[model samples]
Target: MGTREIGLPQRVPGTGLPARVTIWEVGPRDGLQNEKAIVPVAVKLEFLDRLAEAGLTTLEATSFVSPKWVPQLADAEELLAGLNKREGVRYPVLVPNERGLKRALEAGCPDIAIFGSATETFAQRNLNSGLEKQFEMFEPVLAGANGLNVRAYLSMCFGDPWEGPVPAEQVVRVGKRLLELGCTQLSLGDTIGVATVGQVEGLLAAFADAGVPADKLAVHFHDTYGQALANTVAALRCGVSTVDSSAGGLGGCPYAESATGNLATEDLLWTLEGLGIEHGVDLDALVKTSAWMAEQLGRPSPSRVVRALAG
Candidate 1:
């Protein structure tokens, strides 16, 4: 939304990767929310179209949270209503509570992701309730979603903004609770982007030790410290496949200071290619789409790969 800032591109860490990796694009909801200017629904639709054309199958379209909380996505209903659902591509909305869930369901979002913070402070700040109380809030929504066969996602599994370096045990504990609460997939979010490879390993190891299956976890990292892709490699090495990212390297939590975009989809795809990991995405297409969205938003991309390529 301003003048461009040129930067160096960083190579992803780790070794020969898997054949394919799934990219869960969150740009529509997460990316736009951080912009000072409200993005038009037409622009949002165009952005989503480009992403789907680039071979992205899963996307977080919008959040059903109160407009008072996230004015950027206040048009959540209209946005969802206008989306031209592409076959095989799953568009999920972030339903914050029962009310939000109702709106998403009414808007006909077949898939949804319910958010619950791992730390009490974040839960209170974001959800207006304590950790235990947040679960209570999710109970009915989870039950309703389970009945309707909707998906759920939990956030802040790595580190919290209010609380420093969340304990590995706590991560496992919260993860299990969400899994038990009927979350189809649990995304371990590095909310403040303070996670390291070793920390990711330990966190996943703790989950493994807790008898939670590896197939149920997703890794969501922010590139605030330029370590998201590195941490993602670590998770992949640990056999965790599902990764949450945003195109053009967009998004950061409002509550988290200095937090940057979620891991760039372009950067992630490049890493997957280097590792022999398979992701159904087209790297060149992703770069083009990223540039288009950045142009629409009137801002330069936060993605290192995009910057390097454009430069």
Candidate 2:
């Protein structure tokens, strides 16, 4: 093989992967929320614009949670108000509860996501509610959505630090409940990111067996164990077309300190490109954007692709 060819994987076509994938970019929201210092609303707006210009269609904008809980996202309203939302680009916000839902409605958000926990300990810790009670809490938020698009995030799907190895059965049970609560899509999260490719395939199989189609699911993987990309490919092979990624691998679960380093958007894009899948993201543009964000955060990006390409 030529030197350039040796450096790149073959552009294989139609290896049973989805023809198109929707990347749910979570930089401005998930990435920035974990920052020690609160990012300015103007900076967030600029970040969103950069992401949109880089051809990412969906960007998680901000969360409407209690300011005291996640102080970094306290400027959600201001961020949305100042946002120059692009046509055909979606900027969904996270709504943690009924009060959050009300604020999201007032902000004129077209799409929103709710966070759910698969394990009881995480549920109690994150939402301050029991496993079953968390569903009760989500009922009103889903009810008040008024036909707007709603996505649900089920955390600790793979493993939890407090509770070891989550069962696929448990994950499916919580996922179906979330879907039943009017969530259009359910994102399975590896909160502590301990999933291997085998575990990923097995969980997808369990979900399929439970009558939940892959189209209704998205996968949010952290790279704590260096398995995020592997898990993603397994999910993609199982027909999951939507994925959740953070730009520059910037954030993890604040409540779960062990959940570090979300799957980077640039890395996913690189893999998609090599596989000849259509994602429509401008890798160079996105790399530059992440570089800018890293500079703002006063650190280098954790994304391998960003480090390699933008250096």
lDDT value, candidate 2, whole model = 0.89
Q: How much does candidate 2 score in TM-score?
A: 0.95
- Candidate 1 residue lDDT tens string, 92-162: 89888889888877887778888777888888877789878888888889877745544545556777766
Which segments of candidate 2 are over 4 A away from where they belong?
1-10, 254-260
Candidate 1: where is the Cα deviation over 4 Å?
A: 1-17, 146-152, 255-257
lDDT scores in order: 0.81, 0.89
Error of 1 at 228 (Å): 0.6
- Which 10-residue window in model 1 sums to the lowest lDDT? 1-10
What lDDT tens digits, residue by residue, belong to model 2 across residues 1-311? Answer: 00111133467775889989999998888888889998888888999999999999999999998899889999999999999989999999999988999999999998999999999999998899988899989999999999989999999999988889999999999999999888999999988888899999999999999999999999999998788998999999999999999988989765455655799998998899888899988887888888888888888889988887764
- Model 1 lDDT, residue 190, Cα: 85
- Pairs with backbone N, CA or C atoms under 3 Å apart (clashes), candidate 2: none
